[model samples]
Target: MFGVLVVRLPEGRLGFLRAFSGMLAGRWDVEGYVPPLFDREARASLEPQGEATVKALFARAEAMRASPELLTLRAAHAEQSARHASEIVALRERHEVRRKQRHARRAELTEAASKSSTPEASAHAAELRDSLHALDQESRGDKAERRRLEATHASERSSLEPKLLRLERRLRALDRLRHMVSRAVMRRIHDTYVITNARGERRLLRSLYERAQPPSGAADCAAPKLLAYAQAHGLRPVALAEFWWGAPPPSGGRVTGAYYAACRDKCGPLLPFMLDGLFVARPRTFTPPSTTPGSLSILFEDRWLVVVAKPHGLLSVPGREASLSDSVLTRLKARYPDATGPLLVHRLDLDTSGLLVAALDARTHSALQRQFVHREVHKRYVAWVDGIVTGEQGRIDFPMRVDLDDRPRQIHDPIHGKPAVTEWRVIERRGDRTRVAFFPLTGRTHQLRVHAAHPLGLGAPIVGDRLYGRDGERLMLHAESLTLLHPGTGERVTFDSPVPF
Candidate 1:
């Protein structure tokens, strides 16, 4: 069996050897790792004054906004706009009230005429109708007079219009100037060629930014920086990986050791150039020869629902590839062909083995899903992480958002992230490894793993978590227990699964 291995190289393309003992053999180099965000050099380089030219550009923009003429123009525009708004509101209200009154009188007269029948009553109604017609003419005349007055008022205030337009034009010009300077500073600071080893094959930073169209601070993330360092050092990227270190940034979602994919909006475009000459392996896609019947463990079942234990490495539902069609739902469907509604109410990560509650009908599925969304469902996971725990128990409150540069992988974003919280209690400590129970209050992607690894949370990456930590046989995380309200009985129900690790 192949075991985990690490190889180090000074620089160059990875070498491959074929037909080795009936298997392909290859010597591959890792894409390279980037130091944590808080690395001393990285932090120092981020100082605002690191580039004097950029600093000066920003200062110049600020100075432009402080000009005397611009300030006067701004104040004058604000006053004129406010005064005009008040006058317009008054004029509109007066006209609207008069129009409504006229319409109401017309309606009342029409209704009375519709009800009249006797000769005398009809004659009187006819007279009243004539009067109403006369009133309608007068109302029309009133509307025309109102419009003329409004037109005159507008003409009287026409002087301010040109001044306002001129002021707007000037303000827009100033804004454009400021924007240009800011863009230049950002380009100088963020768009500089950092990845040197791309064999000059990679696109320039500015070109990448233009193509990717990422958010303001996206290009400066650790992934692209790490790739830049590797290229500069003449290292050929074989495989790339990143991890979170330090306390969760002001926002939350990152765990200390969980592996995360490169961001999409930020790193997606840049990585293609970085990996230009690398021979990366295509991801494997295959189905096992067979699965034993006992592999589909059923903990609880009834007419409406079934709580099945999902084995690790097995998908909860069919994957994108038809070759990966064998899954818990597909297997269950073979046995219970009549099962209706959404078969699975909630899902566990493909790597996480757990007790999954599946609903047999649509109503039951919707009910269970509602409970999950409202945070009424409770979940607990057991994990063995690569660190010793000093704290007895604590809660991790971190905001999480999908990193635009790296898709699927989440990041800590304080300004624009959803709140994620997890509570943990240490089960035991074994030298460098610590076992803990995780109580996730919010269901975010990789919530438990991040909480376990983020410095602010547990400060330890989970053992065997290939994504967040070192590679191993499997991630040492298990969904130990789940608690939810039963869809059928409306009673609180909890299920437990023995931790495999």
Candidate 2:
């Protein structure tokens, strides 16, 4: 990604800083671009040493694999194996022919003995039986010969194996050494990164990722480079924007010239640390989906389960962070202290308001979860899209995957994406907006939201979608109703929540 930061000088003059995410055309220090967050001199020395050793090791391994002595031994063994197999087959075929001939002769002798009517018939039969015994002895001799041939071949083949095995062992050792050397080099390279926050607090880049190895190009994202430079140079950042400027990978869904959010994997951890001293006001704050906030809107409850009209901005389950402890699951756990099993059966997007189900016991939870997994549960979502949809009803089938760059944002990717299907029908068309109901056939993260916003789907962003389109008072989407089989009663049940826009 490429980024530009609108900056304010100490003298109150305005200027902008430009930065690219990582190396542009294999050069880290471009003429006018801000430098990366690493020690250049340290890398200059460390990278070459590691690269040279890795290359040399690879070259040696490749040479050893193609050595003539090894190849010749392998060829000799293969050729001998084929010859032995052919010889054994020929010997078996000959024995088979001899056995068939002996059988035909015995049949002819038996027929002649049966036709004879006198004493010669009995004597002839005895002679024929004796001949059959001789043939059985010949068959045993052939079997012995076949076993002897196989043993000889095995002994001959073993002769060349010791040399071949020794050569391969050397190659395997080289591969292990190469891997160790490469890992050592990368570890040192990570150590060279010295990242700083706005508070001027310094830390190693790898430290931000904790025990995990920082992903490749960890401190090299456009956000970090721009913010880090601004912090270092005493420039105050007023505004920032990042956009894709080049061809995206074939498996990627990024569009050239399209603005993008900061990548979560590389920048998610770094940005929070870097923006420590900045008063970064979020574009929008969580607003209640209904008239009330922090109060549970229990739609239905029974001995086995409970369904709540989850307000928007409330997480379906408690978040990992301590700050995000307020959620539907947390509230339920507080109320039903004796509730057994994981209370949550399914989840809704944090910004989506809708009917959410929770089982009071483990058996109910398991059964309810099965309904969702098998697509037996039905959900209806009410949404007001920014654009007036042209059709009355249609199914949107855009396969989706999480945008690796941005958390919680999805992109259309048929190749490396899960299937997300939505059946929708227009309820009302209001000037430039359309109110619609969406029935999702599959449950994925941000499924309904993405199906509404993606160009391949409805070609319209849900009104007030901050991530997909523009920010507003709240995301104009709600889980209006949910239908599922009651685990306790063995009957179908439906729950409804008023659509709050």
Candidate 3:
């Protein structure tokens, strides 16, 4: 028989080995590898907890608003108001009938007197006039009585309104208090937990909670929960990946299996601490271009304004990273050194190749921007979608908002979303893909892309759209044309770019 040796490795040594493995995987690992909430019961129970708490508070507020005493008071007020309204209606109806009767009698008497000049007829007419005068006095009394009744009704409503208002204010205060408590609870949850860095250093939860405002759904994210689980279990943290599963969210940027970097505001500080012990590899640096930016093709140019055709993969302007500092704006500025003011008037997504206009001077820029703000400028795009279109043409009206989980991604949110509209026409169908022309009525971010992909909209994701569709060589979307009034000549000018598939 052979004796077996059992060994428990030191924490430092184990951490080092894990770090080395993490570093090796880090080059291609852009997304968080947190395990998804696969348990239905767990996800269902966890998500509704906060919502249920808030709803319970709201129910309590409703109860307070409808307290026994308040309910009684409201019921009494409603009864009195109904009674007063009915009385007023009856009184007016009676007075109107009487007045009409008197007027008819007076008219008959006057006509009889006019036909006959006899003293007897005149005397009868005078007697009728006396009766008419009495009727007039009665009508005046009715008016005064109506006025008194109105005053009484007003006084009653005034008395009841204050009590109702007091109750309403109390309910509102309770709501505010409930919201405050909820926020405090959320903050505590975000602050009490701990996150371990790649280097295996654990830090307080609040240290990683830095942001101008907490990122959307910060308390409910899976990354923190996954890390907490790893720490609790004796598991080594190696690589992190988080992907969106289920139906794509509103903005259509999220696709299944697509890797996304951690959000700057939400996961920026937290990821650093979480990856502390691991040997995290740096992202490959993108080299700036040395050649004359040939991708920026000038479409139209004048003394005050210029329009340029921007190719895919080139930024409209310099990005935050120094490597991405070279862009269309930079190249144009370099070419026209004498151009004044901010040259680029508008922007296009780096992934979308399109026509963009710029102003050479400040005044022209202001005028051109005004046109955009007033919706005088027109923009059109062409794209190939993943599915065939059954309809020849249609319109999409979907409201959009930034996704709380993913910053760059947008979701359909009718309540909080800005209005976005797009009109689309099928141009051609090549096998499974359909080429479409898009007319954007409202220039919301990702308006055309979302409109094409959203289930409620077109239900066809753009071909080569990594965010909304399957990953491909490129995003098959192009800004085909732009039409705007020239600020200097006061003439409408249209710029066109050939669609590049």
Candidate 4:
């Protein structure tokens, strides 16, 4: 019987050979027997007599030689697998950390959105959304790059493969989170606008409703609360108390019962109630003194010109309608009825006491008008404001524009306004007030008054100015000085008025 004999070597190196022989035997249906090895020499001595069996053994030995190379390949494969697993674990850890950070940032943004109410809040939300979007795009790009890398390494056993998968999953999660956060921010902005708009509309409706109602008993229904709320929300209040009481009281005297008696007759019933509790009563309606030709001290005079001191409350010229009576021009015309062609060269506010120049003919009027129009004539005024001025006389170059809502009032406009330049110097500081001499380079309505009050922070307006000055009936302001060149003779003339303050 032909038999496959396997010799056992003393070392365990023959274990794989033994297993292979068993497998071959099973396949070929040969009866395989194991023979014990005595020594290396004895094994070699039987090699010639057992050549056929030996040759079969040598073939099996040659197959066994390939096992070491297979084992090395297996070892390399295991090491590559472990490296890939480690990379996957690391990527997963990074993904978890990034997710947590994103969540925290979203919470912070939500909290900030709650406290902001201005339009700026909406702008901020929009910016945040843009930033989140950019991050999402970056994450997507990274994912694509990671996938590309994974594909390149797909054929090789790399530990980084699983980690790349985890990284891609984390990036997708982050993109979703960014989208959600952006949506939430936009929603908050919309909600804020809706709430503010609704509240504003409701307030407007309520105001109209209240104004339409009939006046009832005085329950102190003053909208003080509403006024405060409106002011806080940048709204102007409309329910202002209408007082019939005239201008504020003079600084030296208190309002007596007699003053209210006269006010009641002149202003009707509301006057007494308005003036009763106040520190000062309305000014007594007094008849102005007759202009007895020589009563006003004429500073300069000629056939073509007349310069004289103008008393407070007397108009420079008559107005086109009522509330403008007993003006200086009216008195001058009356006094000089035969003096033909008498014309007003310039005008001053009724309460501005100053040296006013008038032209006696059209020729002089045209000349003076040209001077003023060309700004060739320099004008100056002395005013007393309610604060101590520390600096030496200075110039305020702020531009000005008319306040349209408060007609006749001028306000500083740095942009989109006419250029106004006023030069001022402190003449004297008395108590808490300073007397300032002003030179207005450009002719503007209420130029000096607005510049001093707003830009210079001068508290008091012109002393006797009822509209612009403090809440006293007295006009503290006086046009104390004037300067100009003679329209005909070209001589420089200066006049000074007694300070009214």
lDDT of 3 at 240: 58
TM-scores for the candidates: 0.59, 0.55, 0.63, 0.43
User: Against the true structure, whose TM-score is highest?
Assistant: 3
Residue runs of model 4 more than 4 Å from their true location after superposition: 1-296, 338-342, 456-460
- Evaluated against the true structure, the overall lDDT of model 1 is 0.68
Query: What tens-digit string does per-residue lDDT give for candidate 1 at 1-501?
Result: 111112224644353211101111232122232322123454346545545644665566567568676677667667866776786687679767877887888888778877888778968777887978887787788678767766766775575566656756765676676577656555554544444335576454556656434456454555555555555545555555555554454434444545555556666666676666666567444453344323879999998899888887777888887777878888889877998876988777666777888888888889889988999999989999888977889999988777665455566677787999999999998888999999988889877876776666777878866545565666788888999989789789899999988
| Model 4 lDDT tens row, 4-88 | 1122234422211111111233332222322211122543454344555435545554454355644455566667777767866
Specify the highest-lDDT model's number: 2
Q: What C-alpha lDDT, on a 0 to 100 scale, does residue 267 get in candidate 4?
A: 22
Q: Predictions ranked by lDDT, top down?
A: 2, 3, 1, 4
Off by over 4 Å in 3: 1-157, 173-221, 225-229, 250-252, 263-272, 283-294, 401-405
Ranking by TM-score: 3, 1, 2, 4
TM-score computed on alpha carbons, candidate 3: 0.63
The runs of at least 3 residues in candidate 1 whose Cα sits more than 4 Å from the true structure, single-residue gaps closed, are: 1-176, 185-294
Over 139-248, each residue of candidate 3 has an lDDT whose tens digit, in order, gives 79888988998998899889887887788788889899888867765555444444555455766556566542455444234455455445545555555555555566
User: What are the RMSDs of all candidates, in order?
Assistant: 9.7, 10.6, 11.6, 44.9
